[model samples]
Target: MSRLTAIIAAVVACLIFCLGWLAMHYHNAASKQQTRAESAEQQVNAAEAVTSNVLTTMTIFNTISEANQHAKEQIALDASGASADIKVAVASDDCALRSVPDGAVKRLQQYADGLRQGAGGSATGKPDS
Candidate 1:
């Protein structure tokens, strides 16, 4: 009878040890899974941020392009009455200042100034020519 009781006690001890080992294994697996899930979530957020930035940049670029086209059209309309053989004087030296502005050069400078003003007037780079 004593020997049988000893055998039963040994079996209970073995069962308890096995349960503890299984619990530890489950905890380790759960921890690893949680870490992986967090990493995946972080990556998704980063990708979304990058996509949003790229889209915003593209929108700005398109706006600037449209404004530039509009400015070109305005300039063309304004210059319609100008002679086809318009002469633009060129400075031989970069440091030299022209004594008098050529007709075409003066118009170009005026257009540039208009463009600067328009760009400052709004977010878009449209010139108020």
Candidate 2:
């Protein structure tokens, strides 16, 4: 071959090799970016699932707390009504009033007060807003 043609042919081969190398580099970079995007998407999905589970757990706790408060209110009411009935019955019987000590009644009242406080209710046995 002539000298000029040989030089031109060598330049063309070099150009083809450089283009192949560039294409391979670009493909590798794109694959790495796709992998990163997939990992980020998985992390986001996991976060969403955790948030939903926490919300559900909080809802259940609230439901249980409200039920407990309602039961406490009912118990307080029943206790007070029974106290009034007992007082009336005891007042009518002199012997029974002498048998029931005053300390026992005070202890019972203290127990009811603790129940109201624990149930988030007022001293009047009403649930707090």
Candidate 3:
């Protein structure tokens, strides 16, 4: 009976130790998992920030490109009109060379105004030719 009692005590002690060990092992694993999750979340946030910055830059570039295109079109239209006026002046016998100069100047002024507006600047209050 004494030997049996001693054997039982040893078994109970071993069982308690095993349970404690298992609890500590599980706790460590949970902590490691939490750390990994937090790291992944931070990485996701960083990636989102980078994507946002890239989008903003692209938007700005598109706006600038649109402005440049508008300016170019305005300039081209003015040039075409000036050319037509010169052609008409050449065909007319009564039209003086001074008349062609005036028309050309007016068209150049309009082109300058368009460029100013496209550059986000105020126009010089010049009338369109």
Model 3 poorest ten-residue lDDT run: 119-128
| Clash number for each model | 0, 0, 0
lDDT of candidate model 3 versus the reference: 0.86
The clash number for model 2 is 0
Which is the leading candidate under lDDT? 2
Please tell me which model should have the higher lDDT, number 1 or number 2.
Answer: 2
**Best to worst by lDDT, what's the order?**
2, 3, 1
Question: Per-residue lDDT for 3-117 in model 2, tens only?
Answer: 9999999999999999999999999999999999999999999999999999999999999999999999998999899999998888878687565579777766766787757
Cα RMSDs of all predictions?
A: 10.5, 8.8, 5.7
lDDT of 1 by residue, 1-129 (tens): 999999999999999999999999999999999999999999999999999999999999999999999999988877863534343333355434545559767766766776767646322444445
- Of candidate 2, the 10-residue stretch with the lowest lDDT total is 119-128
Candidate 1: misplaced stretches above 4 Å? 81-129
Estimate the TM-score of every prediction: 0.61, 0.66, 0.64
- In TM-score terms, candidate 3 sits at 0.64
- CA-lDDT, candidates in order: 0.80, 0.87, 0.86
Q: Which is the better candidate, 2 or 3, if ranked by lDDT?
A: 2
